[model samples]
Target: MSQTNPMPNSNETPTPMAMMQMISSRWVSQPLYVAAELGMNEAFMGKLVDLEMPVIAGGRERTETEYRPLLGAAGFELTNIVPTQTPLSVIESVPV
Candidate 1:
């Protein structure tokens, strides 16, 4: 009798069904934490990045609320936003 594997064959390109099964499975995905210079004017450093990022990198700084939907759309849940003494804030998220 041929055994049918429940896991996807990594050699082959993953189909939408395989991807969905992986997500719905009991596999625990790793969390993502990003320490970014967010748009908080606590030390004036955040304002600097907020102003310069758009001109220099064509990316604007974002608030925690602004990042919620953005991250959520990518299958991650915005768990926590921890602010440091500096302008940087740790944005924590877990995969859904």
Candidate 2:
């Protein structure tokens, strides 16, 4: 015995009612679903290193001001930057 497809043939044109249903459907939901699953503000950073490291490695350090937005994008809020007697500084952040 041969099985039959319930769907209409691909070569056949949809009826006006079917076309209207397609137009009225929520097409934006698919994109919104994907965007929610993968955060819109997700951050990716690479190849950036501190200036104290060798230039042969080929990367540079970013300032505290620059890090604020990056942290926020990754779902954390930058609270403060504390500078010590040494060249290094401490960064504090908490989840939003």
Candidate 3:
């Protein structure tokens, strides 16, 4: 006689990385949905150049000199960074 099992095999369980990816995908999309609903998408329509301002993470201000190397290491060209009136603040021109 043969017995049948109702439970799924252990191989069907999701791995840690797969679970994280699922969560991260949802987390990233929520902001994009909000931005579209707030008319941000329409405002940027037909704009050839867009400016990206540096974010102050953890309430700490980072100077351009300090962030340049880090951005360079991340494969971004540092020569594209433009200085603004505010100290330690830089804006980058991104082509849309």
Best by TM-score: 1
Candidate 3 overall lDDT versus native: 0.39
* Residue 58 shift from truth in candidate 2, angstroms: 9.9
Q: All candidates' lDDT scores?
A: 0.62, 0.47, 0.39
Q: For residues 1-96, what per-residue lDDT tens digits would candidate 2 score against the true structure?
A: 342332358787766445423333422122111111222222221222243334412244677777888677655577877775444456766555
Expressed as tens digits, the lDDT of each residue in 28-72 for candidate 3 is: 232211111234353464231223232223234466687666555
What's the CA RMSD of model 3 in angstroms? 14.6
Q: Tens-digit lDDT track for model 1 on 1-96?
A: 343444556678665445434554524244233455556566587567778676533486688788888777657678888878775567776667
Distance from true location, Cα of 18 in model 2, Å: 46
TM-score to true structure, per model: 0.45, 0.38, 0.29
Candidate 1 contains a number of clashing pairs equal to 0
- In the order shown, the candidates' Cα RMSDs to the true structure are 9.3, 18.6, 14.6
Which candidate order results from sorting by lDDT in descending order?
Answer: 1, 2, 3
- At residue 24, candidate 2 shows an lDDT of 34
Predicted structure with the largest lDDT when compared to the true one: 1
Q: Give the TM-score of candidate 2.
A: 0.38
Off by over 4 Å in 3: 1-58, 83-88, 93-96
Question: Clash number for every model?
Answer: 0, 0, 0
